[model samples]
Target chain A: MAALILAHHQTSPAERLKDAAAVAFIALLLGIPMIGLLTVDQGGALRIATRWPALFAFVAACFVGRLVLRYALDQWRARQLARDQADTPAKEVSLATNPLLNWIGWVALGVSVALPIVFAENRYVVDTATTVLIYVMLGWGLNVVVGLAGLLDLGYVAFYAVGAYTYGLLSTQFGWGFWSALPVAGAITASFGVLLGWPTLRLRGDYLAIVTLGFGEIIRIILVNWTELSGGPNGIASIPRPSFFGLPFKPPGDDPTFASFFGLEYATHQRIVFLYYLILVLALLTNLFVSRMRRLPIGRAWEAMREDEIACKAMGINARNVKLSAFAIGAMLGGFAGVFFAARQGFISPESFTFSESAIILAIVVLGGMGSQLGVVLASLVLVLLPELGRDFAEYRMLLFGAAMILIMIWKPGGILSHREPTLRYFANGGRR
Target chain B: MTAPAPLLSVEHLTMRFGGLLAIDDLSLDVAARKITGVIGPNGAGKTTFFNCLTGFYKPTIGSVRLNHPQRGVLRLEALASHQVARSAQVVRTFQNIRLFPQMTVLENLIVAQHNALQHASRFSLAGLLGLPAYRRAEAAAMAKAVGWLERLKLIEKADTPAGALPYGMQRRIEIARALCVDPLLLCLDEPAAGLNPRESAELNELLKHLSRDEGIAILLIEHDMSVVMNVSDHLCVLNYGRKIAEGTPAQIQKDPNVIKAYLGEEDADEMRADELRADEAIDQEAVR
Candidate 1:
């Protein structure tokens, strides 16, 4: 106790005593179960040992540790204050890292594409890489709604489900191919997005989130219960896989299949590689489309509406059209990804499009910086691969995931990359500001 | 002063929020290419009147009209908020500044011309393709934004995020953003509210230039006596949701009702008028 007070600066005895009391209270909460109680076996009989000395020792350690930490922090703050006063005029430090970060983004893109080819023999790595791309696509799609537009959509998976189901029904019922049904599926799902966004124009924040959540669940429940259209709980099965344009990936024949056309032996790995490239192209297109939109008038209006909706209206930017456009475009991209998803899986059910999936995609967008395109790729890799790698942890996997999310929030509260570059910059060499 | 058929006319404007009537049967006309000042005691429905004319709040009873040169005689009250700015060309700034804080000062101005640029981009299709047409419109928009930034002495801070700027600079940015809308009638609610005396003096010059040289009608609501006196061509005073007195600045200063309203003299109005009449008689005797 004397050492605790002597090392500190400016803290009164009463304050030091209060700090000790608070630490002691916390010690009582943590120390009792951890140190005081011990389970033991005595000749096949269970006995509970009361380790009061150990508990007291734990409490003392906590109290001393807190006092020392407080003393060190106070000393550091005094030094910081003196240094601030003695400053030789403040100098401007440039945060001019956009060009560097741009190079890194390009390197990441290259690595993502080369991953499957580099690990060709390792099926686990290729499969996980494919899964990461799907999530990357979904994250990019939801980034438009949640990040740029600042609309909190909890049920984004509804559009994904709509696209999957649309393609499923079309290919099975009408015999339309993946290439043909892709645009149709996207259009239908976009209309569904419009249907959801239209009535909720007046709602924002939590109310909008609740309505979207309800919309997602309503779609899932309908897929589960409506036996006619969706095949009820059984779900649609044996949906056709996407073909390589005019040729199908199958065994060689006298007629030209994919392998026979190339004069190569048939292999399932080719189809997997083909599907990997398919999503890569789709996700790249989605990124291109969104990045282009971000520079345009409607995109600026969407962001401005997020910043200040009343101000958007005052500036003659229609908040309703901007928000609805955001929803539609986001849903359209999600639908595109869904078409690829259904085609890749060859089977999907309502279980695949649950609220948890929406939450994960949204988590990817937020864990990335909101409104950042490149951040989505980084966040998706972190989220999807973390869980895949954590498969060895089994039951503890989710606990690790939650702890990582908490740590990320503590470390970078805005996000991993919250720095925003305005769409229209006045100067050509404008990075510092 | 001669009024040329009025640019904006608000007839019997009354705005009711719940049980409280914020504005009551207020009628006023704002002249074209002239600065019209709206002043009153605090909570005198000055902001509410602006809101009604700008179509933010639909008046419970009234009609607001704006005479656009090309798109003539538009009823502002019937239009939506965005249309009131875009179609009728009647723009307004807020009492509390509402710049898009996260956006750069120049981007804030660019967003103000959203409707025109959105149209020029052919509904964003041309924009996505990066067509030359959209580029031209965007370049024009940038030129306009840069011009305003230079005029407001904010060209140095053009790339700074708007929220990081000082309060007075943010106020100038907001006004500059409003000017980007190409408004025929600019309604400014307390543009001088947070400005220092020097800033208010700058604001006075800007308002005069915008009204006279730029040929935009200005409806200004200000509490700063120096600002209102320096730039106003016409002054209207409000008292408790009703128009108390209105005329040229000189006439409004001498009006007994205007003085009584500001002083809150309940029984002094009749007594004050008689005293003015007695003073007038002494002046007449001195003249004879």
Candidate 2:
């Protein structure tokens, strides 16, 4: 039925005008109150002023915009239809199964690896790329919970904050280095994940989302109020940077710095480059680990639970354990990202871990087809770079992001790449066994 | 009749939802390696009874004991839902098909054998490392899935998502998925609900084969009289959450209470009126 509509539906010029006029009508109704009328205070009394010309302009723009958008969409669809016919019936191929996507993934890896080297001196490029990688890593983590296990986790930033604070307190109070505190932070964050998951075990869908949102707020409030341990709202500064094994990337000193040990010139970009590579390796490892997990029994159980919890139970899968494991593993990965975040920034604050950060991380997971590993990378790039590039727009920066999100939702509601690859496959030649 | 030992014995099982009594004082014995058909009209508490047995609902006052060969008498009601399938090896399919819609048919079967593979995977450490033992376990699971898919004639559609298939095929896939658990007692709730005549016939053959050749006892809850009469070794009829009749197929068909329960009291009253008129005619003929 949908295919029939797609094949035959063509708008005449009059029909296009009608569609745009409808949009214009709605715009007039909405814009009259919101944009046309403005309240101005004159000597303690408010008087309403009408901007009829501005409203007319706004409505006209809406009409024209809708017509152009519709025309462009129709052209794109026509091209897609033509290409689809020319193609081999367009099989349902996922990113994991498609050879082209596989190659793209490999190329992406190559580009990421060569990026730091290609732009060794350009701090801004490497730094932005690193930021993108951080989101990619966080997206992959949240995917385990939201994508695979079907848990709506709104407080994921809580785990990230826990990890950051864990590293911050451990290093500042106990004088622990990044290497020593990384695993400890992860474990602490995982426990925090469990702490958050335990109560929400019976909850699902919107209720679960609400509870996790509260949990995120609770962690932030604690960090803000607790002055002794967390340094209150001031946060902990001077958090140590991760070293190259034992060699710190420092200026010339008695002790062997990374530059001195390598007999290279001391440069601050060395640390930035190291940080870039550190996150790069960390993100890659996270990808490898998560992808490997998808093929494992536990991972399959998570997916099964996500698909149907009642059926999972009937099939003898303990849903509680599956859900909790998803939370713990997801939190652990988020925690690892947090440790890197703290190390890279050399400062920690509750202000950095906010609800919007959680939303962005989640958006990356969702916008990149939920379970598609490569999707996360693509989405992170678009999400992070769009804002960076939109810096020129200043006030309209966020507006651009919102518009892109809305466009993606309209175009691909399931996701950019929604096909899921089977975790296991059978062959005609007595496969596996 | 010399019946085999009972595999699952329900002693006065009762279930109540709020003020409504769904199942009342229902006692039944499902024999080992035999198909026991539970037939009733809509809302006869047949599904409610299955829910009680499968640990979906806690029976208000009764014991559902599964006599496992190796594990002794296991109290199914005492165990959690998953444990009922895991340890007790008592698996069930839903009246409304509950196969994982997004998962492939093969993946659905593999998920059924999760416990065995999970244990072999050693907390996923072995699976992550792709160890030989875990690989072998996974291979075995795949082989088992393949075997069931082949048996159910779903091998060709193994890669297809379970939900995308036709309803009759989905029902078969659900049974095949349940079979992957290697269940000792398979409880099927309305397995033949949406089946056509040909499909129901195929289901009859499958149920017989399961009970006789595979030696897995089945507790079938079906509304299809042809299926229940054709394949069931013993039939138990339920009415208003109470057992109306229990016997072999032949006996169950002739049982008066069973007929009354099924066709309603009006039919039984009409049946009595016919008998009385026949008696009056016989008396007049004798006098002549």
Candidate 3:
């Protein structure tokens, strides 16, 4: 149908010329004041100077450029018409279910595992990679709620803050280690998830988002005002780092440390490298867990509820339970990521768990495509690496990042990977029924 | 009501929506192992009745009792929407065809059996661990979905998204999905609205097979006369949220109240004239 319209609306050469002439006239009208007339500083006095030649050249360039651009567009459309006519009718295949995407996932996994080893000496590179993985894990967590369950959560960082504070306070006040604190933090965060989800389960769309946004801010405000518990904006510092199975990665002390037990020289970079590998494993486990859950009955229910809540209720699915489960599980994952963040940085404050952090995490999930596990990896890389790569363009970093995001959204409105895959197929062995 | 007993009975069902009375104090019985057609004009409250029975809306003053074979008598109106299907074994399809558009035909069917799978999976713990019990339950669900797809002649499109299928196929898919719920009483809303004559005929056969052979009671709310009149063992006509008439299809067709409700006062006169002309033509042919 679109091709038919394109084919029928072929403009005549006379009309094309007239179109270019009208564009040039408008350009001249605007260019006269801005380009033709310029204010020049004449030795402490300002004077209006005329640059008619430059202005005419600019207008002439616009006219020619418009004509060429139109001609090129017409030619492209004509080619598209020809191709569309000759081609077979396109069948709607699930684009995301391609075997090639699975292969890409495997290849990405391989590279992520080998990255720290290959760049062992470059702490900067490994550090940046670790950041990317952290975001990837958070993206997967948010994907469960926003992507699979279709809940627009604007305050996911609240869970992250809860997880971090759970660990920070436990370790700082109670002398708890990372291993023991991890589960406690995750459980607490999951409970918090349910707490927030209970009241907002009846709300949906924009209202739910607003409540979540306020939830995030409320957590931050609590963390700030409750100085006795949270250490206020001054933040908790010198939090204990995780060890290698009771073996601390410290300079060979009286006790056998990680380096001493291995009979190798101790280096500060050892801990950084260990942190990178630790996060890598955590992110992979998160990926496996999320992907496995996607195939489970609850996961399918989540996706179904996302598609249509009323239909889900009609299908005998308890809408409240499905939504609450999604929130709890998603928050649990986010909390786990938060625990790791606190351990790695060895410090955390309300300033660190801001709304912008939630926005960036949500952005990664959306930009990756809702419910696509592999897309999260790609999106996290783009989101994290863009800023790191833009460090040299200091002043323009934010400007470029905004522009890139806009371009991506315009190019793929449904996210980078929009198509959905069925959780279960009748043909498990890839044969038709 | 030839069956041993009616599967579902409604008493004094009334639904008021703000200033509008969607369903008045209406009552009807649907017999087991038979197709009971609820025929009514637009805004006659047929859908409102289905909604009330399905627990989508709380009746102002009424009772919806479902006589479950195993679970004894169940009060449907008091239960929530999901409980209506889960415990009472009463499921319904929507008039506007609400389907998970992104899910495959098989997935949609499988979702209908979520309660069973969820239980066997032990609320997803066993499924997450990939236990044998969960696997068995999942495989059984897959088998059930596949069976319905094959029976509905939708096996070839099982992998296709439900929304992408043609209107006729989507209607069948909806029925196939609803069947997966293992409902004792299936209420279908306008199942033949978008179907062609041939498809409608196929639907008639399917509905009969389901009610008579499968022994599942079907309460069909349809606007297609050819479908409702041909397949319904019993018919109930509703007008202005009131039960105007109830009898066999043959008797209800000749009911004066049903005719007057269907064709207003003036249209009934025109319909009588048309019927008279048709009778005269048949008489002339007999003379020849």
Candidate 4:
């Protein structure tokens, strides 16, 4: 019986490996499209003709690679389990608990935080780090809904848009500074979240996904159509940049620019660095917030709802309230990220808040191991940063990314770093700081 | 005996699903600290009665008044299943085990205690930031879960997924989960249906312990005659959605209506002969 259970649980590893291989193969096959995009003539017909074989090859490679990887991983896991059992005569092995794992996790986090500060000095590197941080924050926020609550949300980017538009319109329309507009954006977005959640609380699974998808589309459509408010497709440009106590990012002089006030040159690197740290702080705050929530009773209730709605009801949990809170909280965090995004870009546009952006964020949460903060961050780093870092693979980049996501799902259906069970803890008594 | 005002009182509970009458004016009292057995042939509205009690299905015409200790008298008929659980403290176990398969045995119990264990800080940003109160509650819940596991003789399997447990063990865990709620009333549906003789005996002991020692009202729907006859302090027999008889175990055993309802007159003769043969075999086994 034990062997059977082990076999059943372990089958996923093999399946995942096969999926990963197939995805890699597909990337190779789709590499032709990237080549075509780069090499094809300006004429549309010529581009299509040149891209066909490359697309076919990419598809074939992905299929074959997936099959081979699956077979290999299955065989490997089986043998490893057998060997481990043989070597250790006793079946029971003492496993370390959460405290020790948490300690190690904190140390690893500290190292990750310090790495770029110590080694990366380039402005572009800093900019990339900041982008990864923004995604990390978004991933953590979405994790609360999709990971902890097990609700699949596809329009997460809408909240992001809400925050950006809130900050952008308020700052540009009135003379409100970045700091003042930030809270307004978050509040407005959270209210929108509640509005969206109210109508869709009864929906579950695929239905919820479709509604969220529609919600995202609606947000984008309204942003594009409402020229009076959003400045239309031309977007809100030349937005005010963030200031350090009324000092602008310019050379030190009577003008009180950032460079002159700080007694330094007005290098663009200064702005990038400041933005990087700002996003880093926001992302850290997101992680802290999600972590605390997971330990709270409401958090456990969310997990309970995710596991089984019927049983959750039997336990006296208000499913509607729990889901509403998740949606509201998730949207609030997305709004915070959006405000930061507006500040960082100094501009806003409907084009930035598309369905694909929502898909990518959802993919980050799914790949990271739903409900795992570290997993979300790691997934975001790989998904967001990897493509940018591998610009040479630009043509095949999106194809590779999509394939990688599919393979990851196949490999680790639960998530790459999902908790074995929903974390059940009460944060009401001042346990978390 | 003061009788405690009958924790759950039903009056003319009738439920109709389209043309088929699932339950017809079935009335029964679930007194405090008593084991009430509901027994009938298959599809005899046993589960439907449990559903009405738990607020899973609203009776077409009836009143289920639960005198709650904390939340004053509640009309269970108007409440949703979750509302009934929260307000009236009514908990139930399904016929087929419904444990979250991927969750651990400990998690199953913790989930059961979710309501009581929730803290106010759960809604705060501090709770979202992983506060110590949340950690302590988690620890307390785990400790309680371990205790429940020990009582169920499932301590060793605490870490194992609920779905990985044996069929009999899973049923026991389901009962244990319901116990975690510290419920005022527990309604179990066909708990003994799939258990073997030995497992059934264990279940009987547990059920007896719950009613006798815990001071909890237990209303169970079972088709297992031996279990129904042995453990019931009070027995209500139903046929075609109508109550045929209600009395003590001995009285229910001799009730001619019950015997006739369970077995038709023509089949009773054949069943009696078979019972006699079975009795002889038991005697022979005892002698051996």
Please name the candidate that would achieve the greatest DockQ relative to the true structure. 3
Interface RMSD of each: 1.6, 1.9, 1.1, 4.2
lDDT of 1 by residue, A210-325 (tens): 99999999999999999899988888888888988779887776668889888788899988888888898898988889888998988888889889999999999888889989
Alpha-carbon DockQ of candidate 2: 0.54
Chain A only: list TM-scores of all candidates.
0.84, 0.89, 0.86, 0.79
Best by TM-score: 2
Candidate 3 residues lying further than 4 Å off, grouped into runs, are A1-78, A88-97, A428-430, B1-3, B273-288
How high a TM-score does candidate 2 get? Answer: 0.92
Question: Can you give the lDDT of residue A358 in candidate 2?
Answer: 93
Q: Tens digit of lDDT per residue, candidate 2, span A89-141?
A: 66653223577778989999999999989998789999999999999999999
CAPRI quality of model 3: medium
Badly placed stretches (over 4 Å) of model 4 are: A1-108, A115-121, A245-248, A253-258, A421-433, B1-5, B69-72, B119-122, B125-150, B155-161, B272-288
Candidate 3 C-alpha error for residue B27, in Å: 0.9
Q: After superposition, how far is residue A289 of candidate 3 from its true place, in Å?
A: 0.7
Q: Write the per-residue lDDT of candidate 4 for residues B11-45, one digit (tens) a residue.
A: 99999999999899888888888899999888889
* Candidate 1 runs further than 4 Å off: A1-97, A430-433, B1-3, B266-288
lDDT for each residue of candidate 2 in B242-286, tens digit (9 for 90 to 100) = 998998877776667877887778897778667556656755765
Q: What do the candidate models score in CA lDDT, each in turn?
A: 0.88, 0.90, 0.90, 0.80
lDDT score for candidate 1 against the true structure:
0.88
Sorted on DockQ, best first, the list reads 3, 1, 2, 4
Q: Write the residue-wise lDDT of candidate 4 on A306-367 in tens digits.
A: 87887888777788888998999999999999998988898889999999999989989888
